[model samples]
Target chain A: MKGVGPTTPAASQPPLLEKEGRSSRGAVRAEVLLWLAQRASAAVLGIAVLIHLATMSYAVRGGISAAEILARTRGSLGWLLFYGVFVLAVAVHVPIGLRTIAQEWAGWRGAGLDVIVVAIAFALLALGWRAVWAVCA
Target chain B: MNRAWRARNHPAYWAFLVHRLSGLALAVFLPAHFLVLGQALRGEAGLEGALRWTDSPLVKVAEIAIVVLLAAHLTGGVRMLALEFLPWRDWQKSLAALAAGATVLFGLAFALALVGGG
Candidate 1:
């Protein structure tokens, strides 16, 4: 996400003792899950981004117009569903990427950081869904 | 300094840097993009006003920038996926250059469309 650094930075640490093993296991599990989620969402987003770019390039031929934008999206179940999945993937992908950046650059870690990022992810979901609703409704 | 520079001065490093920056930029842009789209919820008039605002020359330039950043992020992402999944190849290192080129070309095409009255 951020640096594409070692995916299992902590996992590689040889657990020299029981305490180290126990402490790192949970963090490693959580990190590995997040890494997988980021990659999976990236796959989804890659396709979505291509579709969106192509559509927008074609749609804006006569300059952007409100009518044109809304007409295509309004009451379109396909668009609604497509964007719903897109937003869900985005909500998963973004916070985890930001978590990596925050850790590397700002040295933020621990439960406090995790809580804030989860809130951020929810905020993204709400905003993204609102946009989808705006277009579809 | 020399050793660190040697370590960091790879094409993949540059690709990583661009990907991170573009992702951050897109994250910042998304909320604003949503804000504009939410204008539609207010009614056609509101959305129309927002669309009219975007017709300005300045917004057009920003639009191009956004498109290019999007291309950068996307191609970088694709490159990441290929690197992660595919068997390693010496030519894969060239993917960084290919991604950069593709980003520029994608932006150029969008700009051309815009200029041609799109």
Candidate 2:
């Protein structure tokens, strides 16, 4: 919006764009917040996913059995906490990622889409915690 | 001018595509995974039933595929974070290649573990 002096006006300018511009930026603030959350959760997940992959890759040596998995996970408070945080991070990370994908691929936007994303976030949280509770409780 | 294909035909775009597709695949699998894990609530029989279901040859393939997708997504995510935070450099361009390579290794290691275990 700068450099629009009498002599410096070099291109076609939309009339009365100042207020609209401010409002648009304000609207983008929500998107900025979502982006921030996604990044933070990604950092958490980077560590968590690596740990998870390593554990699984190394632990399963002669086939997987429910009994062995249960022996390791059942009643383990530490595993519970580890998975709890992992679930929470996934809950935050997946929905935001999906929202972006929806926007880019499906051309879907607006409050309706946001509401659906929120629903997905809650579902992930509930389902994830439920799994944790099953193992830990 | 078919500019879209040209624009997307690069290492970065391939990286982006793999990341997004893997993410989508994982998301689709999440609920089923949660449900299966939650079977622990029903004790050994319940958990055993789910394990038995996954004993099929196809499910084994799917398991491997899921591991590969997860590795791809995880490595791609790390690349994305580095790209966003680190200073730009020519070497940084190779991060995508490195991530892809690492993903293959993860998939291979997971596959080996599964084979040895199974």
Candidate 3:
């Protein structure tokens, strides 16, 4: 029942997914979803940033030591998951947004873009996890 | 000459300009953030002293302004994406106008609340 419009060559033909590229309409839908994902992740990161900033101010004002902060974070599921999602969103969202700029500015696409994006994602993940470890471990 | 003014009037054009401006502002502020927090690596007094510096009204004002810029940048970015990617081009102009109004309103509300509280 998928993609069975008037363009169907015959009943015996393969499904659209078996084809090389996603259908034009399907590609547009995917792009729209990607845009939404990027925007939603940005909003999530914004809220997280506000919370992080306010808490940092409060912590310093209360004279909480670094060790004390670490003590609070250690083994805390809430902090772990909050930062984990933060890192994940940054990894996914930043590279995808950068890919657009790269395509427009550097004329890079396809495998080149994929490789750069993956590299950026892993780099961000590594840096983020390192900081998280310093605080949470 | 006229073309330049016309481009400036375009909502998308202004949004792009604001995004770049906000990005620069954030980039500058982020270094100061790291430096202030780096005081924690020293001792409690050092960290506390850095925070006392933050209690200055000037820093508070700058922070509030940055928050306003961030909100405007974000709202504009969202509107740009909607106009570019969505199937609702006919409503883009009206939606863009609404977004601009929301940006100003929300930015002011947030800045006033946070800065006043700070």
How do the residues B3-114 of candidate 3 rate in per-residue lDDT, one tens digit apiece? Answer: 8797688766666767656645653454355455456545546555666765677976776677666566566667666666688657756766776786677656655555
How much lDDT does each candidate structure score?
A: 0.89, 0.90, 0.63
Candidate 1, A32-87: lDDT as tens digits: 99999999999999999888888878887879888888999999999999998988
Backbone-clash count (model 1): 1
Off by over 4 Å in 3: A1-40, A43-76, A102-123, A130-137, B2-8, B23-52, B84-89
Off by over 4 Å in 1: A1-20
Best by DockQ: 2
The collision pairs in model 3 are none
DockQ of each: 0.62, 0.67, 0.13
Candidate 1 displacement at residue A75 in angstroms: 0.6
Selected candidate, larger lDDT, 2 vs 3: 2
Top-TM-score candidate index: 1
Per-residue lDDT of model 3, residues A12-55, tens digit only: 45565456345666767866886788777776766775566556
Report the error of model 3 at residue A91, Å.
Answer: 3.5
What is candidate 2's lDDT per residue for A2-116, written digit by digit as tens?
7766555443444446667887898789889999999999999999999999988876678777898888888898999999999999999999999999999999999899999
Mark the regions of model 2 whose C-alpha exceeds 4 Å error after superposition: A1-26
Clashing pairs in 2: A61-B117, A62-B117, A63-B117
Scoring model 1 with DockQ, what do you get? 0.62
Full ranking by lDDT: 2, 1, 3
Write out the backbone clash pairs for model 1.
A61-B118
Q: For candidate 1, write residues B1-118 as lDDT tens digits.
A: 6999999898999899999999999988988898888889988788898889778899999999999999999999999999999998886568998999999998988888876864
